[model samples]
Target: MREETFKKRKPKIVVIGGGTGLPVILKSLKEKDADITAIVTVADDGGSSGVLRRSFNAVPPGDLRNVLTALSEIPELQREIFQYRFKSDDRNLDGHTIGNLIISAMTDMHGNIYEAIQLLTKLMRVRGHVFPAAEEPLNLHAQYVDGSTQTGESKIPKKGKKIDKVSVTCVEKERPVKASRKVISAIMNADLVVLGPGSLFTSILPNIMIPDIGDALIETEAKVVYISNIMTQLGETEELNDADHVRVLHKHVGGKFVDIALTNIGIVPEDYIEQEINEEYLLQVEHDFKGLKAEVPMVISDDFLLLTEKSVYHNGEKVAEEIFKTAFNSQRKIKKYL
Candidate 1:
């Protein structure tokens, strides 16, 4: 009986990605009580993070700040304080977020990115593990189909070129960075691994581009599930269908090995989508379910769609609930009665 109970343990889920999309799912997964290990990308090179990186040579903290806030158990007031961005025009403080600065300070104190996260986890009362994909800041390099190459995550999309592949290197250096052993161990031990609803190229790929983490994805016993973005991203994934997303991921990873693609299929009220003026989120993601299933091992669809006041998003709690059930089912052994 003890053995059976042990076998039915809570699912260990490692979620990979960064940007606004990551926090949405994480907050949901935390409520569902899954063991979550968020492996965030360090390839950020724009805005407040970029300015700080240049000024202090620190790892980009914007993504980490958001993830920490998402999983933080602190009261809403405190969490909000951390997430507050200054709107001042002062050269010293304009566009800087309090959370980013805190992370920067933490990084400086510990002299280690990993250690800083641990300290913040305790302070923020975080529910589960949060890890930086690499200790050092990373630069994203994209090789476009036209045989052209560009470096920096912020600049890649602006070129308006079709991406062939992408890789991560040490920021301002040429060497490849490897994820810490803990990040790899989390993936190896997880019952299920989830990729993003973020920018596939910039947010998700950078984490997997690390040599060891990439290899772990190919080798880990864990089931891999990808959360498809609800809407098309203009530069990164414009005019692409669901199948195209899967194809891009597999091509970069060197195989069609992703076990499942959890896609959002529910129709958005056309007027609801139109109310927002941003052109990027206007179109719902196109579907090619047959193609996704053909390349990825399995494809699952649902009404994971969510709408905030001004935008559409994946309902994180819904995703977490479904993902937990799927992982639990995949990992548990069901016994038949005679």
Candidate 2:
């Protein structure tokens, strides 16, 4: 391709997270010309993914599946095929998402999860890339409020105990599959690196837990921005406000991992609040990012969340839009080679 063609391309953006939050960001960012690489955490151990991981000795595929669907250009048919879940009744297909089974099978065929994801990305014609944080099947270990340890990522929240801290454990030598050279290069060369609106412990932090990945993020010259969660997670971040979130993140990856923090300042409508109370089990609180005294400046906006009928999350487009605005503003003032 010509240099002009490439230069006309949007800035490269690497978003790190897993599960629903990642896709929401991806979906919004894809609208822009930016190149997106979603580096997903693979420590999930629940649902159809849990069954496959235990049976086949594979990295949990639920998060990967969600990311794939989010980036995929295909219509409802392909997405439905990928997201199809079997019933819990007696059958060989029970409790498994079609995407998980397909990914597991691809991993078996290619003998690696990385290769399988690459293949699927090509098949789906994703706008950007999606890679697992590590090649090995990993487990998340958490120390609870009572000082008890929980082993699985899925089980940690359900335990109903406050999480004291969290860490990732690999089945093999702790060398984190060395984040794809392309990913590291992207981070090193990126104009902006976005963390997440995902789960603090399970989704977002897992990426930083990888030593090499964390090192790359820390060493990268790009401006780093973290999008804080809007509501408190039941078990993981029970009473955590914006400042508490940053403190926990600092404790894990040290204070230098972030450059800026973007948080929602909007209020949920009263009807929306009632719906959240009855269905989603979430309560909105004022995020205290001001108290963090972070090195990077913090930006707050009235980016209201979109609530779904499923009683879970709505789209994160408003937050993503604010993030892009902040990034663009930052880049305009700071020269690329500076």
User: What TM-score, computed on C-alpha atoms, does each candidate reach?
Assistant: 0.94, 0.88
Candidate number of the best lDDT = 1
Which runs in model 2 stand beyond 4 Å of their true positions?
1-7, 173-181, 269-274, 277-280, 292-295, 312-315, 329-338
> How much is 112 displaced in model 2, in angstroms?
0.2
Q: Residue by residue across 1-338, what tens digits does model 1's lDDT show?
A: 87788666777889999999999989988887577899999999999999988777878999999999999999999998998989997988999999999999888988988899999999999999999999988989999889999999999988988888999888656665889649988888888899998998999999998988888898877889988898877668878888898888888888766999999898888888778766655478887888887987788888988777868889888888888988887673323211
Candidate 1 clashing pairs?
A: none
lDDT of 2 by residue, 131-230 (tens): 8888767888899869899888888888888887888877564554455435666567676888887889988887788777788788877778877777
Task: Give the lDDT of residue 113 in candidate 2.
Answer: 89
Q: What C-alpha lDDT values do all the predictions have?
A: 0.86, 0.76
Error of 1 at 284 (Å): 1.7
